[model samples]
Target: MPAYVGAVQVINVSSSGVFHIGDVIQIRPISNTKTFSGAGSFNTGDGLAIYNQYSATNTLDNDGIDQGINFNL
Candidate 1:
């Protein structure tokens, strides 16, 4: 069987510039584990958010966090 992959939410935090193909971006799941959604802004250490720092070129396939979500940018 194949591994189950959940839907991910992409967010933009870069300066005023168009996103490129290989541009790295932050992403997280839209679940109850975090007090966030695909809409609106958020702050660090909001809720039970699972923090992850991934590149758009690598996505969740690279190094990331699973304990809590917090962005310092």
Candidate 2:
């Protein structure tokens, strides 16, 4: 079966330090019921930015699904 692209939510952010450019990171879902379909990336040009480069083909069947990405910095 094809995987689904579930919903994404930002749970927290780093309070200290500044993120820089050319940074890559992988983020997993916060909820145990949900899973990340693929890897993700991050880029910080002048500010912190997160990108979900991986394409999700599947989705959660029920409610309370949480997904997120990380910063390489």
Candidate 3:
């Protein structure tokens, strides 16, 4: 079977800007935003929320917890 895709949007960002590998990018729909309609469905009004953090240690940012987990495990 073939894979299908819904709404596709391309955004051009600044190359000179300092963007970390784990950065969250959020996009809000304006008054004229449109959604995709057909075999697949797209929700434009909801907008898009991206979470870039992958490591639990990085997210927690606590050395005590990390030590506890390491000792317990």
Candidate 4:
């Protein structure tokens, strides 16, 4: 099995983007950054709120699933 495309038009690819017209085995996109705020303090929260701060490291991964069909092809 394979893929076929007639025509396509890609305008732009952002800082974290992937552009492919044909078959792709795997795509791993990662974004890591550091933030610097000059606010008075980090004392801001609501009833339904969470912590907000600059993370020293990004421990986020795109490992949501591991199926058999993906490798079958």
Question: For each candidate, C-alpha RMSD in Å?
Answer: 20.1, 20.9, 21.6, 10.8
lDDT of 1: 0.42
Comparing 3 with 4 on lDDT, the higher-scoring candidate is 4
lDDT per residue as tens, model 2, 29-73: 332233445444233376655666656655556666445434322
Candidate whose lDDT is highest: 4
Predictions in order: lDDT: 0.42, 0.47, 0.39, 0.60
lDDT of 3 at 15: 42
Candidate 3: TM-score? 0.15
Off-target runs (Cα >4 Å) in candidate 3 are 13-73
Clashes of each: 3, 6, 0, 0
Best by TM-score: 4
lDDT ranking, high to low? 4, 2, 1, 3
Worst 10 residues of 3 by lDDT: 64-73
Candidate 1 lDDT by residue in tens digits, 1-73: 3455576555974443344333355633332242423322334565655545642332343445555434423
- Itemize residue pairs with steric clashes in candidate 4: none
Distance from true location, Cα of 24 in model 1, Å: 13
Clashing residue pairs for model 2: 3-57, 3-58, 4-57, 4-58, 4-59, 5-58
Q: Quote the lDDT for 28 in model 2.
A: 38
Cα lDDT tens digits, model 3, 9-42, are: 6576454334333334653322322243442233
Per-candidate TM-score against the hidden true structure: 0.13, 0.15, 0.15, 0.45
